[model samples]
Target: MRSLDFPALIYILLPEVFRIIELFHFHKQVNMYESQITLVMDTICPWTYLGKKRLDEALAQFRASPSSSSISFDLQFSSYQPSPSRPETIPDRAAHALHEKHNDNEEAQKLFEEHMISLAKPLNIPIAFTGPTGNSFPAHRIIQQVQESHGPEVTNKLVDALFRLYFAEGRHPGEDDMLIEACVEAGVGEKEAKDLVGDKTKGERKTKEDIRSIGMDIDSVPTVIIEGRRRDLTLTGLKEVSEYVKAMETIKKEST
Candidate 1:
């Protein structure tokens, strides 16, 4: 029943007021939208590699911008096989395969390579038409395993290493040596890398399931699907960095 002064009452309630404000902010953060980006691609595909690079650049730019302060992103890679029937190990016949795909037209193959090289030059990605071209199943399996065990950051590194190994270094995708080297480069221990590479059957079923899950809708590589709160955005093939940024902005707007 004792009377309290204004300053005493204010002091007594200040801590509770701060606590309430903290709770409010925490709730707001908890409810913030997260966009999930799934990149459906094949390791041997040059266009998918370019698409991944462009998407990475776009995500970096968007994260650095003021408008993306409240947005969160989760990027994941899905497996796709352009030539599912190719053997796990094959000789270096990429050029021949390209020519065959182009109906034995050398000019068409040359033009295709030239266009890819031009696009890659600006991004500093070395476009090579040489390397073992065959089944990418083992490579996809390793990627899926790494993603499951190490999460997205390490998986991204592994994917980048695999791309560089196959495209830039002209290494075989499904070879044990190549897989071990890529895993090591991505920060996986050498022993684990070897073990993972040794078991070719590991992650095979899941990888195949993932490929099948993509279904008939995505009949191409480098297809990116952005899952937003209200709607989803699908981007097929390689796109400019600005375009990816715009897509992120659109998702953010819809989220709010």
Candidate 2:
């Protein structure tokens, strides 16, 4: 009877211990999520700011799930100039002008701002529409310099700074100091940022030329292009998380 009791105890205790260990491992995996996203943005677009915030929340939710079907990914940054040819003092004249032209006609700009605020509320992101419409050459050039040297991660940091400054703080994105500050905050050397902006006469034209080479239409600020096997996916305006996730899933499946 004693010998039988010992083996029974061993079986019961071992299974419980194994179950506990399994639960811990499952918890850890559920908390782990590795994925990447590419955000193509122009600070002039309030929707871009809102879209990014929502995308981040969605990605966070994805990471919190424990599905073996899910794989890790990265978020990459892409450049888009909404008003590539606007003067330096104003960065987003096209969208604003369209808004003003509509005066009493349900202004698209007002509609966009309202939508951005609503979308941003859930993610604790704030956006306003007081920035000037102007050239993005100075800012893009700094980003280009970062991309050329430190790579996309650096580009991402600068992009984030731009969003915060324009959307939340209502700062003019075209202001050289604002851009320089964002660069420095992102670990860009002050001298390099200055050099990029200081050489704006040559730099601005070259920046526009470089942006044009990407071959994207300059009609909108937040253009997201996801390349796939069947076709290239292009999204403009403010997008929801579900939309981005659906596109990402399609791209992932095609690649696999």
C-alpha RMSD for every candidate:
3.3, 6.2
Off by over 4 Å in 1: 1-28
Angstrom error of the Cα, residue 213, model 2: value is: 3.5
lDDT of 2 by residue, 39-118 (tens): 67666666677777766666666556543244555666556775566666745544555655455455665675577577
Candidate closest to the true structure, highest TM-score? 1
Model 2 ranges off by over 4 Å: 1-38, 63-72, 90-101, 104-112, 201-206, 215-219, 227-232
Which ten-residue region of model 2 has the weakest summed lDDT?
65-74
User: What is the Cα-based TM-score of model 1?
Assistant: 0.88
With a 3 Å backbone cut-off (N, CA, C), the pairs that clash in candidate 1 are: none
lDDT of 2 at 114: 77
Judged by lDDT, which candidate is best? 1
- Which tens-of-lDDT digit does each residue in 1-256 have in candidate 1? 9999999999999999999999988986887787889999899988998999999999999999976766788899989886688776668656656655787787888888899999999888897888676779889999999999999989999999999998898888888898999999999999999999898778888788888777557889899998988999999988999999999999999896
